[model samples]
Target: MPSAPGTGKGGGPDHGYPPVGRLLPVGGGVVHALTTGSGPDVVLLHGASGNLRDFTFDLVGRLARDFRVTAFDRPGLGHSDPLHADGESPAEQAAVLDAAAGMLGLGRAVIVGHSFGGSVAMAWALEHPERVAAVVTLAGATMPWPGDLGPWYRIASTTFGAATVVPLVSGWLPDSYARNSVASIFAPQQPPDGYLEHVGIPLTLRRAAVLRSNVRQVAGLKPHVAAMARRYPGLSIPVEIVHGTADTIVPAAVHAHPMSRLLPNARLTKLPGIGHMPHHVAPDATLAAIRSAAVRAGLN
Candidate 1:
């Protein structure tokens, strides 16, 4: 197999990545990104354990008709290089992606983030308010939550896990478990058809760099939000947030509702009985939110 551009966690060729997407040079390492569409730019940030393909599966195609949709693989996941070992915060990822967007020639576009990507999107808008035309967070985790991310993440976040557990799973993790894990995120809402193949499950699973970075990001999310959440009120740009009531992963009540209350210029749309994967389960609703924000910010 051909070598992927970015270095893997163990300092080896990123064979896990296929020869798709562009390798964008930014910061100290390169980030992988894909662009589509023909109008105003819309920057897409995928959640943890995801790549640009998540949007490419459906959302990118839908939005490409009206907007320039650019999707990025979060650093260390998919084909992007891992940030510095200490760089686990949303702010860190946001910085890298922001630089990439500028390099890719995306200017003053609507920033859309889903799940953990929401956190990064919030950071991006906060840190670079001048660059963001508007913000759309889909079931994003912007508020602090109680408890840890269960056993898998708990273990993956540890020093021992990084050295031992991560490599074990990366090398031998079964396809069944990986498939089910992806499906579980959608829960009551099935992952539609052919999501797994389009999503590049093995790339996400087999990359130790991504595994360590994701779990560490999750482990440190609460405090990270605590530091960043206070900055929401400072944002004067239009912000649209959509979250599902049935989302067990990042409940609307736990994140979106309260966060909406905090933003000075933001509105939250509550999707009743919808699960965590709102972008997949409720694309129309998600699209509507993006359109609304674009209109409010006059990006159209």
Candidate 2:
């Protein structure tokens, strides 16, 4: 893979590509995320077990034409330091995002969240409706956490939780392990090789607290979903939801379909034959959804 022009060892700007991965102090510790493009501010949040680099390089560059995109590594995922304070729930994560946006001088902007990030975006919009210009959720976990996530998810969650006991031990999580685990959530086909490596695999593995926080974030979804879904009726801002009909990770029946039904002003776009990671597999369609959502939100 060609290295982004000026991006250095740490994924910073190296070849005039603008910094693709960097850290910014949000509240207490630094928040790890990537910023590129220039236009209406659009915050992109990745899913569970993912960092900022999850957004495809081409997608970020294309979106930059109309929107300044900021894809953040939720607490503990990438270069950002783990959250040490209480209230690391989805709602709290949204608050952290709000603060980060302010610090970056971003006014009301659109939010595009994928998988777990979608949940955070919804919670953020519910809490601070005025700050959000619009929202686009891609295969987001809008419904309550399913009771059955198969044995693997349970084991992984438990393992991740236990790993948090010792920082040193947790830091030893292998890049292969992280990559394989993430790959399992998608279709049989794998993403491009070295994708995780380029996105800071070692940094994420070292952040045990962030992993633990993510496990808790996943577990606490039921109540958050219930409450947030109810608040959708009050949302005046435009909303868009895109989900692959064949998604296996979050399941379309629970999230995309239900969320569309609840949100009076929301539009749902179904992608046939695609899986959970549409942005990686179908960047153009994902970009279209984002642009459509932005237009609906009056960001044109």
In order, the Cα lDDT scores of the candidates are 0.83, 0.71
Q: Estimate each model's TM-score.
A: 0.94, 0.83
- lDDT for model 2 comes to 0.71
Highest lDDT against the true fold, candidate: 1
Residue 163's lDDT in candidate 1: 88
168, model 2: CA deviation in Å?
8.8
Under the 3 Å rule for N, CA and C atoms, how many clashes does model 2 have? 8
* 104 Cα displacement, candidate 2 (Å): 0.7
Give stretches of model 2 more than 4 Å off. Answer: 1-22, 85-87, 148-176
Q: What tens digits encode model 1's per-residue C-alpha lDDT throughout 1-300? A: 213454534234445446367777676677888988899889998998888888888999999999998999887677777787644688888888888888888889899999999998999998887778999999898999877678987777779988899889888988999888987899888888989887877676777777777777777788989888888888889999999999989989889988998898998899989988888989999999988888998888
Candidate 2: pairs in clash: 5-14, 5-15, 6-13, 6-14, 6-15, 7-13, 7-14, 7-15
